[model samples]
Target: MIVPPPLRFGVLGLGRAGVSMLPALRTHPHAVVAAAADLNPTARAQFTRDFEVPAYDSAEALCASPEVGVVYIATPHQFHAEHCLLAAANGKHIVVEKPLALTLADCDTIIDAVERAGVTLIVGHTASYNPTVGAARAIIRTGELGRLRLINFAAYTPFLYRPRRPEELDSASGGGILFNQTPHQVDASRLLGGGMLKSVRATAGVWDPGRRTEGACAALLQFDDGAAASLVYSGYDHFDSLEFRVSTEDERSLSLTSHGATRRALNEGARSPDEETAMLSAMGYGGPAMRSVGPGGMGMFQVELGLAIVSCERGDLRLVADGLIIYDDEGRRSLPLRYDRGVPGRGNVFDELRSAVVDGIRPIHDARWGKATLEACLAIQQSSKEDREVYLSHQVTVGD
Candidate 1:
């Protein structure tokens, strides 16, 4: 068998998103890091040292790399669209991080740019990429569960208390759960509900006086097919929803070990943006050589971002750490999934991107799909502001 040369990937941003994917990109059969770009000199230098690839200080330099066939946009929320446009203009296919952009118009701009450039664009790294989510969606479509009725999804984390950039704690700058986290819930819910969010009623909580961005939200999403999802997310550090996760792995603890330190650091005092950026670079791809020597019974990648409980006419589906559990009149059973490794927990996203780039297949989670998810997220905020359910008009179905 003849194997094609790996698609050279240029990564823009050395912060959480870009750095987290580097390890996976290094190991993927069809992908490779050709270059990277970051505004932080520390990050660029670190990336160059670790990856042995040119790490540019500006997005333009990274995008201009002749070796790059694809560009992965992992910049801050506000920079997503700009970086995407740059990559598209450079004739590189794209795999941009979640929420696509800060606004629908920005998302549309990216869509138009990529369309004009004739390059594939995928906005992801979300729960929709979970194999268990895929399995659940397939099982629901089997008609054995009857009609889909309701979905209960919730996730709690120390997002608000984590070390953050200046834009991270400000709602006006797209720093909040509605932009960063809810995209996962909304997209996954849309996929499970068969897409098309008809309307939304929601309440977004912005309770932290120290950090003025939204810290929590509870949304009721109504799909076009009449399915509904009650989605809740809280970034406050006090309560952890993962504690309630059902898993195939050791079921003893669900604590985020780093949460305490990050929360303490946040509460200690204000931190300079440069200090935080340096800290972010240290945690990213090139900063420090890191290792974890833990007892290995279950795999490290066997985890989910949030929990979901789906209700149908005849049965229910509950997502677990390793796979899924079904409850029907016949009894209970589990379906554990095993997929190819990529991006830690997000194997499907990698697969989809590969197919788009190598086989010229359009991903179900393409630009329009990402826009639909963003539209729903925006509707949640709008609904909260107006104290009324906001209707949606731009939703599209999932899949080809």
Candidate 2:
């Protein structure tokens, strides 16, 4: 019997997103990091020391490694296309972090290259992998949500400062909250709405002088089903927020909030018994007890890698649900009434990536989905600049 080659991986770009994969990769049974590539000497050293994997000076070297069967790209917003193209050319299955590329053109370029290469190309859209998102998808898939009419998706990042450094702050580098932050919500909206975006009308503004990009953006999206989503994204506020409320024509609603305070009380040191009770009361009882639902057990990214490994091994897309099963806590799994069963306010982009990998499917936030999100973001910027309601072209493809 010919044994299949072990799916060795090389991770390119060791920033926040890149580093998060270390724990997940270490735990995966079918895949291991053969090498890692990053430009920063300190980061490279730390990654090598942490993972005991060879460290290369550049992504090109890592992709070229004979042992590497796959490449995970976690570089800054602007470098996704080049890295994926290089890795795909080198015959490596590519896993790119979300927003596929900075622009629709870049997304198309990367997609074309990956298609030509005939290798698995998956974007790291972490939101879809979220257990709550999974449960939500399952619920929606079952038509329990019943002809969704309105989706109010909001993500607020307080202390959301755009980088002051030249390399990190440029719009070309994916600096804006609308562009960088809203893709997750966009994907979620698509998931719950069950339709393509027909058009987008947006308004945005930059409240902070230091940040050239909009600190707040609101978009009104009309879907093919006549359902509409009101998306409010704020990068600067007194509070950090992540929430999605899906309401259907059947008079039922589901709200998913992945944020900070809720996770801390649930995952970290225990609070006073009274405090715990209060937390439960505030979160609303999903059932007997308040289960913490925050992002834990595996961060969003690690979950993504794990999902990919499992899916590749399984040889089918059904693993998407499998990974979700692994992550689901009662809070995450419970229906509308059980919202408080899991910890609130925690999810990582990695979760969606791994789920897609396991299921042998790409998410709505695939290259096309990313493009639509970017289009909406760009429209917001355009509208903000022109002080007019920017209307998205109907002919645009939201995602393929």
Best-fitting candidate, scored by lDDT: 1
Score every model by TM-score: 0.92, 0.68
Output the TM-score of candidate 2. Answer: 0.68
Question: How many pairs of residues in model 2 come into backbone collision?
Answer: 22
lDDT of 1 at 392: 98
Model 1 quality (TM-score): 0.92
The reply for model 1, stretches above 4 Å from the true place, is 246-249, 253-261, 269-278, 288-305
Per-residue lDDT tens digits of candidate 2, residues 126-214? 45435555554564455533545665555565424412233343465776666566666665566556536766777776676645655
Q: RMSD, each candidate, Å?
A: 2.8, 12.2
In the range 27-107, model 1's lDDT, one tens digit per residue, is: 676788899988878778767887888999889998998978888888888889999999999999898999899889998
Candidate 1: deviation at residue 112, Å? 1.1
